[model samples]
Target: MPHHLIRKLEHFTKLSCDDRQVLGAVASKRRTFAEHSDIIEEGNDPSHVNLILEGWACRYKQLDDGRRQIISFFVPGDLCDTHIYILREMDHSIAALTPVKVAEISRASLDRLMDEHSRVTKALWWDSLVGVAIQREWTVNLGQRTAIERLGHLFCELFLRLRGVGLTEGDSCALPLTQMELADALGLSNVHINRTLQELRRAGLIVLKGGCLTIPDLAALQKASLFNPNYLHLDREGRNLDANEPASD
Candidate 1:
């Protein structure tokens, strides 16, 4: 079932029983990929929207020198390329960060959902807008924030985002990326990312071990990073709708 997706969309609006059922149907069929495998490559025609059902994936651009810049991380419940069908080809590639399972939502299926389900359509719009907002914040992260601040901000954002989708456990969440991958995402050297991680650990703001990240004090970390959640637009804008499902992680 696409419980995670339902949980995520309900954060925006109340979903009816029918809405949940249809969404589940769309995500019922899934495909799995091994770690490091490419789910979608640059220049591929955008036919289906991939929904992460398990594990992690990233959308990235590769330079001629073979260096990569990870643009965004996709977790369960995330809809990859919701509006990218309008594009003739994908501008970047999406690869699995871990063994991943995704639901390939065909354009025809998506069109039917949007045409019939008003609430789902609205929530999808919110999802797309939030994606752009996150990209903008990432730009600021790479351009202005110091190394330590960048790492902290990214941690806080991921924790909150995972929590919103019911993937977090208390103050900790799964963080499967390696230090090198973190370096690529933040536009820093591997050594810089290592040093920054050490700094965060020393400050008692984070605990990273065994592929898990524990933020003992999220508020303090957010303060140190100057992180703000406004760009996420997670304030439950469609609170008026009737949501029948549970959203607790």
Candidate 2:
């Protein structure tokens, strides 16, 4: 049913049965990628939009020195590249963090869906805007926050995002990244990442084990990290519009 995509879209605005049906069609074609494999390379001309259905992927860029920086994480229901057809070539690469399943929607299919489904189009726009906001938040996390704060903020954000998609159980969610991967994402050394993780555990703020992350006290973690949810734009938008009608009205 592509409920993950529906749940995510409805977070922005309600979706009708038809909206849900079309979204299901959007996810009809599925592709799988092995863990640590690049879903799309940095310089390749993107042909289709990839929507995550299961597992995780990350957008990252590699420097000439071989250092990699993870720009963003894509969970289920997240689009890897929605309007990337406009670009001549990809600016960054996306890699699977686990055995990942994705829906590959071609440009023609996407355009037809948007042309026919106004609500879906608007929801997509909301999703795109939130992506930009998240990038900005990551920038602040890297440039301004301390190591502990950076890690804490990331956890809080991931927990809420997973919970929103009904992928989280209680205060916990699947976090399959290795310590080295976390180091790459957070711009820290492996040793530094390990130390910061220990500190978080000692503080009784988080419990990360067995490829899963659990927050015992979300509010306390948010405080320590100076985390804010406003950037996610998770609040339901366009409430005045009818779910079954076109969003343009």
Candidate 3:
């Protein structure tokens, strides 16, 4: 692993000195990705399990006639394949939501690391559980919420997720997505998306101008969308420190 990459993972993974030394002994490569690049494709061979060192991405499945259902967006520090470990081929595809950079850790190396250190493996597994929670939230939104509310819920989720990685501002974030991307993720028509967005704007909830989003009434939007961030398990990493009280550098 590169010295800087090893250092960063150690900060996040809550690794012991011994384990960090072991991982640092191995070579880890960084890979850059362009926006809209397909990092993992449905029905393609699964050769590696990737970790996101930077950028945003979405895991999605497309229906016939080109309709798509976005599973979840991957961000920095997220594992790209926590749920696809035993795959003969990828059952779902992952695409960059923005220009991305990742660390490509081969399966063999990951296996050895897991066998040697369960905490590292468990940390990756925790990521997939969060992904599942995001999917559940989506399922609930699709099944229960109105289109406007669904969009609000998704926006809240994305905003919080981005903020977790320190990629968001106080009440807004850079939105690189088009209306089409929003429609696919929320299962609404692009035209409907525009109308709903306009409604939110008129109601003093949010504003999207020039692809930038500003949420003026976050509390109202969260209430309207019925969004709750408890399922994300974002505090899990901190718990390890509380339990162990190990000196961190």
Candidate 4:
């Protein structure tokens, strides 16, 4: 299996060989979940943090009437919620969108790893910072972007995230989300979501078929979506960690 966490961390800082081995060892004891199954339910006490190894999942909350709002999507190399053990119970639920594999790291083990590895600890902190940045971007996306721009921004974000974990090929990637799932994430009705996708397709911006998305012109799509990748914090070095304008490709 790919050392996705290591690869993700290396983007911020290089890890020594020993650090890589330690991360791999700590991420053992993998398990799988079926599609639509809750990995961690709301109000449940979480004793372990999960690292995604395969497939996709989402953090979501349900309304009294059973309407769901997806808070965020989790792809390979994502930490479901680090340090969640500090809380008495989960505030939201994490459910698998596809057949998913995850490695559960116990609180004790995580604490030990942090204590023993300064560089690894710093890398994890950087990872947490990026998570916060993404949440802020999502808030902006919901509050400001139009339906078409909202969906387009989402596609760009996913493409980059998947590319970070080596899940993308060239300009295309597997986008296994259904229209209903997209609607929930974007806070739009299914009809609106479908219409927005059609608009993007008709504009010669994207090719989404068979659960895959291909952006023919990434720069054009970025402009159409009004997307700025500054929130992603993907700089090779830790300098300029704060959000800024998107970097030139």
Q: What TM-scores do the predictions have?
A: 0.95, 0.95, 0.83, 0.94
Clashes of 2: 0
The CA-based lDDT of model 1 is what?
0.91
Weakest 10 consecutive residues of candidate 2 by summed lDDT: 240-249
Question: What is the per-residue lDDT of model 1 for residues 61-180, given as tens digits with 9 covering 90 to 100?
Answer: 999999999999999999997877788999999999999999988888899999999889988998999999999999999999999999999999999999998899999999999999
- Backbone clashes, each candidate: 0, 0, 3, 0
Worst 10 residues of 1 by lDDT: 240-249
For TM-score, the strongest prediction is 1
lDDT of 4 at 222: 99
Best by lDDT: 1
lDDT for 198 (candidate 4): 91
TM-score leaderboard ranking: 1, 2, 4, 3
Off by over 4 Å in 3: 1-27, 237-244, 247-249
Clashing pairs in 3: 1-26, 1-27, 1-28
